[model samples]
Target: MKSEAQTPQPNDLQPEKDEHKDSYNNIETPATDAENSNIIDITALENQMRNLSIGFNLKWLDVNVLPRKVVFEIQHDVQQKILKPLEDVVNTMQTVGLLSMEAQTIFKKMFAMFDGTETEYKFIECLKSADLYVVPREFVISNELRPGVIHNEQGMDNDPITGILMPIKFQLRKYLESPLVFDTILDNLTPSQDGYIRSLVDGTIWQQRRAKIDCNIVIPLNFFFDDFTTKDTVSPHASRTSILGIYYYIPCLPGYILAKLANILVAGYMLSEDRKEYENEDLFSNLVHTLIDLEVNGLTISYNGTDVTVHFMLGFITGDNLGVAGILDLVESARANFYCRMCKRNREQREKDATEYEQTFRTIDGYENDLLLNDVSNTGVHKNSVFNQIPSYHVVLNVYFDLMHDLWEGVCMYGLSHCLNYFIKVKKMFSLNELNCRKNVFVFGSTNSSNIPNDIKDTNIIKSKIKMTASEIKTLITFFPLIIGMLIPEDDPVWSYFCNLLKLCHILMLREIHPKLLDTLKSLVETHHTQYQQLFNDTLKPKHHNIIHYASFILRSGTPRHQWAMRGEGKHRDAKQYSRVNNNNTNLCKSLSIKAGYKFAQNVYNSSFVTPQIDLSNSKILDYPSDITFNSFVAEKIRLLNNSVHFIDSFIKQGSTFSHGTIFYVTYCNIINIFELDCILKDKSNNLILVCSSIMCRRFDEHLQSYEVYKTQVPKLISNIGCYETHTINIHSVNDKLYFRFCNFNVTDKVIESLFVN
Candidate 1:
């Protein structure tokens, strides 16, 4: 393993000292030795656990460099964090008379999960035998008894290995045997809008892991391509072109994170070639044959000993990989193509009023130089085109629309920038007072900071990424209902339509088709196009901005949200970071695969790390000695002076202020975009306001036995929630009417940490 010192300078984790100065000084706490020491190498720990169970006594470290103390720490953590909880539940079940006779059978299985007896690979073998399979690294349920089920929606499973749930093998078999059970399972985990956003941080390192896992592993034989920019290989070959590549995409994984690497099938590169030749079906089919021996062109994988023998279902190629593969233009390139790859239109419209190109028969046929190699003797031969080589794959649905590229960079950036650009350059509304006002509110909300939030007046990370960042686009999409949308000048109306388009992009993921949304989108596009034509005389539009033509048919497959390639793109970052140097440039293929493999190992070992309640006993050191009031959103924090202590004393006596489950706000920090603090007035004459963070009662999930987390609903993400703000909540904003009781910590000596940046 590469040491910290050995990491490349470009991928260095250490930010320059002066680069970012967080406003809340109390946000960071010194790490305790216990916290630092408890960190475990996932592979070693798994091996340790497996070895420890083989005999009776404590296991010795196989690797000499690893300290005995570290092993003890990991053992303690497993007992305290994992097994002890199970032990307690078992005892409780015994005491309550709920432990069933059928449940009695799973005792060994549950024990095996940790004792190393019942491992993921063992379960995978079972799944393969039962005609069901799962990629263990995906952290999802793996049963294929039903159709239309996408990715795992549960951010936190309800400890699926509990006394109440059936045996793992039984559950898998039941789901595979019954579609109703599968549907019930999906319904149980179907996420709410807020819940989906909350899961964003659970495994953010593997952003869009679920999507990639579903398409690549769960969808079975998904035709995919991964996108990455690598340095040239060793010695004689190293240039921009030599390091870049793509394919029918399911061959690639989503989001370049480790989850994506876990799905990588074939890795290769070459000089420019004929489009048809490069995109041959044989290329992907041969890979499938290798993965699981192809049964008459169908692939079946059997887990060792288990009855699972899952047949892999392969699909047509889909990727955000630039259409530069050059075989055909029938399918629009992910980045610039405005029209839908399935149906040629880029926006919503009537069947009769088809303004876009009609190309449902999406094959390269018109040109004399069509690169399609139609051969009669090929194994997976198609009708006329080489693409038809795959039996079940269809050209229309085969084109998987990438949400990250098409929406984030392509659609959001394209539409938002155009509107903003028009407002700035055309409407001459470059400087909106509302935006500046909100910036003041954002930078220093209820705290005395004469200056705006750091770099708000200067820095443009949004524009720095050539107009905007994916995160910025994400903010606009999510907060369109809450905050960001109001910034658009109402006069244009085009921006409003575009914002709705962005919202639709997000909504499609959370729920299925709603005619209202489709109709609304269609109407918006109709007016947007007319006004757009009026603005530029109906000239050709950027393909990304043509949501008007393709929005309808694309939904026929499912939301683009379900097939985002953001995760695949992120895998490149991990590859670049970990790749060992070979005369300066990293070996792209090997290095990438290695990084991906390590990441998969990490996931396999620590899959449940984020799901459990974080032990914050040492971290939650905060207090509020006195009441605080603010006269203005930009005003300084004020301690109460002889003004009625009634409010404070009353809550203090009730013990409702700082106890568990009491929600509170820490008003000094900024949680802009998702949940911001805007000035509101309950009493016009009062000179005081509360200093708090935004808080809301997170919706309870009986299934997961936890709460649904929403970014807008909870003010945790941007704030230093772990240190200073964890105990605080924000005041109700003017626009958002949702307000719970204000909370304040009992001020102790520990509260001396600076609450705001100077």
Candidate 2:
């Protein structure tokens, strides 16, 4: 990142020396010293004006005013003489551009302005004002050293764990001034707009309110930390790099608009090969030291005759299980007796009795007392967390569990592998080759093509633990029932148990969580765990123990989706790409940090907060026919807009894509109904009218754990619900009959009752 304007020197006034000129052979020109003085050096003069101090420097006229640099000016009559011909060329170039051969003529005419000319300069009077420009500044983080042990080179020689830190205040100030937050707040600051802004406040049941967040601008920040390998895993020269990422969401704008702004990488360091220590207090202390002042004083930004004080508070410290345990100074080994971070349960206690896990929830006072003991065998605490330096943050309350690691990769992989093995070897439903053939032939939609899982290997199946990515596992599980639903028996206990896991996944993936939904999630997790132990005759893994605290975590924090490590892990791709192209392994951390700074500056300059545009070529405007007739209400609605309707095949709005065959739900007369989009109509005012066909909800199938529905030929007319309610569906063909199953969350009993009431 570049710094603010630097102070200029007096020697900068000298003109450049020509290399071709020789003192002995130079010819004396007719121009004298008086004639040469008429020519002004415009570049040097501007530099002198920029660096002049008001009180210290003497002005030419003793007037306290700064000067604005101006280029050559054009006369009024001269501009009008060429205006018509210039307009003609501009109009032609606008219609036919650089792709065509005719653009050469336009370029020739445009270059005439600077063919050959002597430029003139002027200085305009302007008042000097104080402006703010927040730039990224790098700070050094060093490991601890013994007293009287001085290093020759600043911590690089003695401590190989030295890292780079980007101060949080500078990054926060830049974000607050960005169009994402500044423009949105300035545009809608009225009494009626308070409700819309207040919804963006972090108001989870467990979140403590430092100030009235709704009235003031409060930024709730979530910090993510993880380690990723930049080199290929198969290669002998593999290297591991640890990264720290920051994420914040603005309440006024929709969540999807800010998706690209999440997971900003701010700190990183290379992991040493010889370092095997569990705790690093010095590393984290340097990172959070700057945040202490930010939490108390708050950042004040002045612009447009107003000073806005914005507060920064820690929302959550999130990462994978290993990363989270490392930062919190807990036992990093999952196989240890005291493994879980949220509770203190020994292996014997977990295996013998699974109930009352909440009775041993970790608290602040308990953690403090355990720090005094400094024993990892009993309390699982070797040292205190560096994040305790922040005022309102606590390790037990702020650290969140990641579903990408715990459920998708851990529990889901283990359960699915066992079920597949049982189906192949014991039941003799189908051969493994036949199953792989079906998996290869299944057609995934365009949006999901990149997440397709690889072929399942025999070795993985035999071990009862599959190896796959989180994205692949999620995609496969979503359509797993549809792929092999018919092969299994209708009343298989193993298949039913797997469905319970599916229910738990759907609920956890939701962006918003209701109190009623938490009850459903808690029951589903308990039942899923009990079923796993009874069927497999095995004890709970460490991930299973971590899953026990999710409901309690969500009750205090917001949704788990916002705290997952998926986005943090995704950010490693940039670093890997940079490493591949440049092959710079010596100073990898510093190189990645500089690249991140350039990306951040580009995002701010281009104003990436703008909404996505819709392409009109994909749609067509419909013409009204004189022969068609409609009912009174439909005719009146059409007449209100003079029968102007656009029939769109597909279009994007607010980062969501709507197409002809999309499935959504809407409330009509206080009842929710499932509607499959048949066509879309837009009037002159741009309000959408959905022409959809209703799919009747039959019943919530216990065996499939999804809603069994039959698509009806009934057509319905309703307005667009702005995509607030939607669900994922799976299609099945059983004996030449079509079956539809919809997976949804927050399904209250009233919604289920309403579905079957008719």
CA-lDDT, candidates in order = 0.36, 0.59
Candidate 1 on 427-456: residue-level lDDT in tens?
655454444454445422222232222212
Compose the digit string of candidate 2's lDDT tens values, residues 391-448: 7777776547788998899878878987888888778798888888888887665556
Q: Which portions of model 1 miss their true places by more than 4 Å?
A: 1-223, 231-237, 240-285, 291-306, 321-340, 344-388, 430-466, 476-511, 536-551, 580-587, 605-758
TM-score of 1: 0.45
How far does residue 99 in candidate 1 sit from its true spot (Å)?
46
Which candidate tops lDDT? 2
- Native-vs-model 1 lDDT? 0.36
TM-scores for every predicted model: 0.45, 0.72
lDDT for model 2, on a 0 to 1 scale? Answer: 0.59
Error of 2 at 741 (Å): 3.9
